[model samples]
Target: MKRSRFTEEQIIGILREQEAGVATSEVCRRHGVSSATFYKWKAKFGGMDVSEARRLKALEDENAKLKRMLADAMLDNVALKDLLGKKVVTPAARREAAAHLRSAYEMSERRACRVLGVDRASVRYQAARPGDGVLRDRLKALVQERRRFGYRRLHVLLRREGHAVNRKRVQRLYREEKLSVRRRGGRKRAMGTRRPLETPLGANQRWSLDFVSDQLTDGRRFRTREALSLVVDTSISGQRLARELDKLIARRSRSAVIVSDNGTEMTSRAILERTNRTGVAWHYVAPGRPQQNGFVESFNGRLRDECLNEEVFASTAGARTVIERSRTDYNHVRPSAHGGLTPEAVRLNLAASRLRNVTSCAGRPLPSAQQIGHQTLGLS
Candidate 1:
């Protein structure tokens, strides 16, 4: 792409001299060019005037410009295809993408920004935000203290400790530090028509029972029997289950119906006798349908996720202590799905609602026994 020493007008003038019967040798000698150069010019502009040569030069310039533009458009297309499906919401991410396009596709900065649909100023912007070194160290310490906590829960903890940081900032640092909790793959769900289970109307109306098993550090296994929100650890026997149920009933009101899966511990003679003695109805769900008894199943999932999976119990006593603490936290401290209220809070709220209903009914006249019997028989 070296530029020629002669302009188009000069080259055309020299060619005219050759066409006017001047010797090509004389023309070359006068112009300090070789005969080859003169003949090359003659072949190009032999029948062209200066105006035509100028027009040809302009066309060549325009064609070169168009070629450059087409090449840029093709590079932009390639950059866009490469960036497809990639989330570049942040300025830092866009800057990185711009750099990638420049290195990968040989695109200019302006072209890269245009192709990425980001402003060039944004791509060139330097972040002036303060560093999170201290915050990150504190966050990692909190993570070590509570390894089972996710970013949202950790954000809550940070706020409790009086850290003036945004939740999004914490999330960003959480990702950058690679502190994400590893999750197990999901199991395939059974697909079919599913009937919803009847919801409990009151505290002592219904209860779900389930067992969760885990191992001590010595590899000794233990089983925990969960009754709705209650958790008790014991040996894997129906006698122990009955004893645990008795203790649970002693502390709380006896439920009218107890739901459990078709496990041996649940269907054993000891459990059946205990239920009969307590005048409680024992119900068994279908063999592979754990969802039929979902209350305890959900609790067990949380226990496994937030407690059992996070702790290493050295002994049965240690396991019991940790599990009891986790149960206390779950019932009294941890927020439940009932509008972020804990289980204890929900129980208190339900009790308050029932009291209000009773107080409101206090002024109403009592129904006669015969009327109650008719209502029970669904008579008008």
Candidate 2:
């Protein structure tokens, strides 16, 4: 390294020698500083008194130390312009980051929800769906009364009443409100013998029938079978019956075909004669093959799950009341997967998706839909 032109003591000495009138050359040569360097120092220190120079030097030193500290902090990720709004919640930060990432993978919302540990619904967004409070309330009334409408049928009803709505939005809001005619449930199998029928292709084609049994806290038991009469119309879902065994079709034209297994009540010459008397076709699946009657069995399992299973009924009347309430919910409020549309709405908007395998694409038939006596959601 090159030697410095001036030293602290030498600089002071030079200033002192200049004050004493010593030859500048002798002072410069003694200090090992060239004339130019000497003059530069003189100019710097000459006007400022010694105390000011020292104070300025001290300030410079402090500034250099602060700069080094700041640089080190930057390297270690600690340097920040404003510490405000930093991660107040460490765990929440991780969760929010996961939520943002989940927003990116729109294809797999469940996976994203798992990664984020958030409700799948928080990530599976349906865009702005405005509800006309009055309209929705009215619809809710109808749903409460019917309890088994899919969105398509609801949409038609709504249009007739002058409430224009997007069926898809209705489906989303229906789920968010959990106001569908049916309750939700997990996967399960059926009880007893049944058959699986192909998803229907036309309206008024097929209907499913099943009974829901519940026990009262007093140990009294009651049974009521919901017809779950699905009206298929070249679409997966047509309409739901939720019809109790007591209901009679005063207007026989409402149902064209009835499909069921050889249950005692259904096989009783009485029920068979009833269908024959109504001029409706009756189709029965071979025994032990519930898949042949997939539609109603699915409904039954759901009835058990969302209604019978979600809660414990205290009495026969309580079970009946709860089942009736859930029936209305199932018909009108539930979002469905058969078409990624409610069973009611599948006919108009997502009809294309009907019968296209909601549980999988490989088309594996779901387990026997004949769940009875199990806690289920709707129609069971």
Candidate 3:
């Protein structure tokens, strides 16, 4: 370092002269310092005697030395951190350091940790964690068993099996072992919004019609008209379907609305003309979507599962007998999941409920079922 022209004592003397009202220019000229330098000295050494000024200089020298030492220590720390980042340290790094210290310098584990600037517990850490191996084996077995299940399902199963592990731990191991299920590639189309099928409050208010086909013992195919009443026959044509529907409507009550799919037999001219003449509203479900007509589809599924699949029909008469018996049992004997009542009981209950406040087409009291021939129609 270059030495200063004036000592601390001389600088303090110049500032004291300025304090005693001497001209600043005269002081600068006498000291051979510029007015700016005089002002700088005044600012630094203002209101101090020579002793205090020398003490301040000594304190500044000590502070500079301390700062230089601090900077050197910080540089060493930075170097160590960088080396550690470049894979200089592993989980076994601390143990090796401890062992080196013990062999080379005869230092204990505690002294080695202090010298190496590492945590004591980290230096003493064991390679195997408690139950880690067993947990990994269980996770692998579970993944193999449930090929389609994901991490969430595995976590649930693990919990059910009395494992006290958390979902995050399971997920971490699952990723490490590459146990994720392969996802299907194509974008999946969504089924449209599902709405419940309309239920009739009375017998003739609404009716659902669907056609079900089955093979006889002789391998000949036959279709059944499933509606309020099932009509089984060998051959099913548009005209035959229309005639059967008309007869069903007459035998039961004339329906106001009929729900069905857009099948050829249903949309034929004969069936359309019959619906128009009878003043019945025909509602067709969306094409290729059978779920929209869930009522008849569900009934057909039940008939197939319970009766059709078990019985082998020999003749049309035998088929009709078996189907009629099954239909009767379904209507009168089997308790429906819907409202905990049989189909017949539900119809009767709905009719009775509406009858308390219902009237007839002529605005007259409708005769009871006992008085009429079981063909009473209520206000829709």
Whole-model lDDT per candidate: 0.72, 0.53, 0.68
* Model 3 TM-score on a 0 to 1 scale: 0.43
List the pairs of residues colliding in candidate 1.
Answer: none
lDDT of 3 by residue, 122-187 (tens): 887776756567778899998775555577667766776788998899997888789986653432
Q: Report the C-alpha lDDT of model 1 over 1-380, residue by residue, as the tens digit.
A: 58898999899888888779998888889989998888888788889988998999899899999999998788678778988888899888899999999999887897788788889998888879888999999999988977777787777668767999878999988998999988755446555555577644445566667778888888877776122333335465788778767876777757778777888888999988887788899888876777676566666676788888888989888877888787777666664444445556666665676687876655554332111111000000
Residue 143 deviation, candidate 1, in Å?
Answer: 2.9
Candidate 2 residue lDDT tens string, 116-186 = 45565544545484556776686677677546566666665676577767787667556656775544655
In order of TM-score, best first, we have 1, 3, 2
Count of residue pairs whose backbone atoms collide, per candidate: 0, 63, 0
At residue 86, candidate 3 shows an lDDT of: 43
Clash pairs of candidate 3?
Answer: none
**Model 1 segments beyond 4 Å from truth?**
1-47, 63-90, 99-108, 115-117, 124-135, 159-171, 185-193, 225-236, 352-380
Residue 183 shift from truth in candidate 1, angstroms: 2.3
Overall local distance difference test of candidate 2: 0.53
Q: Could you tell me the lDDT of residue 220 within candidate 2?
A: 60
The best candidate in terms of TM-score: 1
TM, every model: 0.69, 0.39, 0.43
